[model samples]
Target: MEKTYTVSVFTENSIGMMNRVTIVFTRRHLNIDSITASESEVPGVFRYTIVLRTTRQQVDKVVGQLEKVIDVIKAFVHEENDIVHQEVALYKIRTETLTNGDVEKVIREHHARVLTVDPQFMVIEKTGHVEETQLLFEKLRPYGVLEFARSGRVAVTKPMKELSTYLEEI
Candidate 1:
């Protein structure tokens, strides 16, 4: 059975490394649901978090292939429960919606905060899992959302040991 998997790839900062890492998945015909890259705890190292729906066998193979990339320092595949993750979503809604108390109530109910309120539009921000963000989006839709954007997942493993420790052991 296929399941969602989050692959974390640690690599030395280098040009074109992202392209090479993504090519591995492209070659396998796997579609990446989301991908985010940023500097890791280790100063010179970077981390790539990629989410995809694939079988365990296929994910394992993808991880193995990722490890073969020249700049990849380490790669690990994690089940949803194995890591804690979150995504940020920003919603742009017409400023007029704020005139009605219902919009404020809806925002409060969803636990979203108003980032900015201008004459033209109001910006609201929500940070949570995909479902949470989507729920907020749906609730605000009737109020007229001018724009919506949700970022890729950002995650950290559940293990107590820090990533730096793993890098040292390697």
Candidate 2:
């Protein structure tokens, strides 16, 4: 069965590494649902959180192939229950539509923050699971949303051991 899987890839900083890693999945005809890359806890290492909907066997194959890429230090596959994940979404709404107190109520109900306010528009930010962000977008659509963007999934495993800990052991 196909389900969401998070691939945690660790690598040394190097040019073209992302492309190489991504190509592994592409060659297998897999679609990446979302991906976020950032510096890892260790100063020189980087981590990529890649989400995809695939069977366990395919994800395992992808991770194995990712590990073969140059500069790739390690690759891990995690089920949703194994990790804590979040995505950030930003919404721009026209100011005229947010003139009433109801706007504040809506924001409060959604646990979103107004990042900036101008005479013409307001920017609202929300960080949570993807589903929450999508729901907020649906709710705001009726209120004249001018723009919207959601970042890819960013996640860490729930295990007490940190990535840095493993890096240290090496």
Candidate 3:
């Protein structure tokens, strides 16, 4: 059965490493739902969080392949329950609509906050799961959403041990 998987890849900073890491998925004809890369807790080491929907066997194979990449120090595949994750979404809506409707109530109900309010438009920020962000988008659409953007998933494993510990063991 197909299920969502988050692949956490730890690597050294290197040029073209991202392209090399992504090519493994491309060759397997797999589509990445979301990908985010940033520096890890350890200085100079980077982490790539990639989300994809595929079979467990396929994901395992991908992780094995990712580990073989030149710059990859370690690669791990995690089920949704194994990690805690969140995505941030930003919505830009017309300011005029706020005065005409109960958009404030809707925003409050969704637990989203206005980051900026200008004469023309207001930017609302929501941080949560993809579904939660999309829900907020839907609720604000009727009010006039000028723009919307959601970041890729950022996650950390549930285990008490940190990535540095794992790196040291290796």
TM-score winner: 3
Q: Report the C-alpha displacement of residue 59, candidate 2, in angstroms.
A: 0.4
Q: Relative to the unseen true structure, what is the C-alpha lDDT of residue 52 in candidate 3, on a scale of 0 to 100?
A: 100
lDDT for model 3 comes to: 0.96
- C-alpha local distance difference test of each model: 0.95, 0.93, 0.96
Over 4 Å off, model 3: none
Alpha-carbon RMSD, each predicted model: 0.8, 1.1, 0.8
TM-score, cand. 2 vs. native = 0.96
Question: Against the true structure, candidate 1 has what lDDT?
Answer: 0.95
Per-residue CA lDDT of candidate 2, range 81-119, in tens? Answer: 999999999999999987788777889999999999999
User: Would you list the rank order by lDDT, best first?
Assistant: 3, 1, 2
